[model samples]
Target: MSLPLPATGTKRADRHWWQTACIYQIYPASFKDSNGDGFGDLPGIISKIDHLKSLGVNAVWLSPCYESPNVDGGYDISNYRKIDPRYGTVADIELLIRSLDEVNIRLIMDLVVNHTSDQHEWFRESRSSKTNAKRDWYIWRKGKSITIGNECVRTPPNNWKSQFQGSAWEYDAHTDEYYLHLFAAQQPDLN
Candidate 1:
């Protein structure tokens, strides 16, 4: 029922640093707000570096801070390569990395690739028309309405439920199809 532990003597030092390092997770939006903007930015995290160092932390893991609609608290990313304006600029992130490195703190980012914001460029192009170049980038399916006791019932492609709420698929009026979203309607699963 239990897995065997690594050799405790000589093998202890051979293990990766992550096996023993204390990693701290920070949700940037709620961590610290710089510039009185009421939203956390890379600079805000940089300002707290001393606290992390004093806490004996080795690495810092951050949730998604990419450009997004924030429909799912920044998980619905609109752009993967750009930082959200509310979070600061790419230069600021570089500064944060350098600052963390000065204190021996590794920076880790949460990569949310299961799905993306419906407003993402690729999603927009995909939904623009069925013949679009990126139309196959996202899941799209036809749905049917079932008649039960005289009442017509329209449902998603399947009975899959969304983690956020309601059905896992949202009907696109323009595309005349339903797209799968494991979380919120704003986040459509990639094909």
Candidate 2:
């Protein structure tokens, strides 16, 4: 995986209009579930916008509402192009967007391009045979160290600690090398 580095002389800072609009963050799963599947869906959130609008809120920051494996509590996203099936679908989000617009309320969805659900196609390919074209999408390095017949089996380039509770190195039997995992052993850092 790659950590996109900023240009040598560039500074990028977000300054959206909503920065001063004063909004409330909504954790959809805990908001409400009309279907009672123990998981909240878009319809449930839509049914309650009136409550938020009445509260004088203008913008809503939706938690990781996109499809996820629920790892990292949905913050570790899987896909960037669609809505999570458990919550709803693209159409559901579209309707919510339109409805919110009618009330002058803004809907902001989360984008997690980094590590994805292991089930995500990106991660799937990343963990697959290293020769796969999709492998470079994420950071994959050998174990703490490697050597084959006197040649170095090149480990990850850094001597860094995994932010997660344990060492970041994980051996992949498929590729005979260790890959980096900055978070949970399963939650490898996103590119």
Candidate 3:
């Protein structure tokens, strides 16, 4: 899915540098504090692009700029279409995107698709009473009240251990069900 290479013999910021274009990944909070709010904003990013350019990185990848609850380090996105208020307004993202475009530097963003933070609407509803419409959005099973049928698969359907070194199932209070967890109890597996 990669695009075609830039035209040959082109006047560019970095030549022969395409093979070794300067690529930079910035963690906004640690990069700069534009508003002095202890968080990095688009202006902060724009201000630092020169430093990156000086470092010879021809491209940049932003960790995450979309709106989020900041749980799981912003990997749990609340709204992909908006920028987190802690960061800046949506205009900031657009300005950053346009600025990067003008400099011929590519901008990459982190995309999160796993279960969002508990505060996210999906997880909130999934945690509600068992009959909630979004309950099935996450994996949940009926509690241990069922007697196994003759062919009922059980015991984790095998002996596969969760990476967290424990039984994979977690008890849910809402549905009195057991949900699979691939990590800590707090991080319910979205699989």
Candidate No. with top TM-score: 1
Rank ordering of all candidates by lDDT, starting from the highest: 1, 2, 3
- Give the per-residue lDDT of model 1 (tens digit) for 1-191: 96556675847578778878899999999999988988888899999999999999999999999999999999999999999999899999889999999999999989998999998999999999999999989999998889999999777899999998899999998988999999999999998
After superposition, the stretches of candidate 1 with alpha carbons farther than 4 Å from their true spots are: 1-10, 148-153
- Taking the tens digit of each residue's C-alpha lDDT, what string does model 2 give over 1-191? 96555556543354445544768888888887879799888889899888989998889889888777786778767777778788888898888899899899998776665567766778788788889888877777765457789887656546676776656766678887666677766666665
Steric clash pairs (candidate 3):
22-56, 22-57, 22-58
lDDT winner: 1
- Candidate 2 wrongly placed segments (more than 4 Å): 1-16, 145-159
Candidate 3 lDDT tens digits, 37-69? 888777899887767766767789788777776
TM-score of each: 0.91, 0.78, 0.70
Stretches of candidate 3 exceeding 4 Å from the true structure:
1-21, 129-131, 143-170, 181-191
Ranking by TM-score: 1, 2, 3
Clashes of 1: 0
lDDT of 3: 0.70
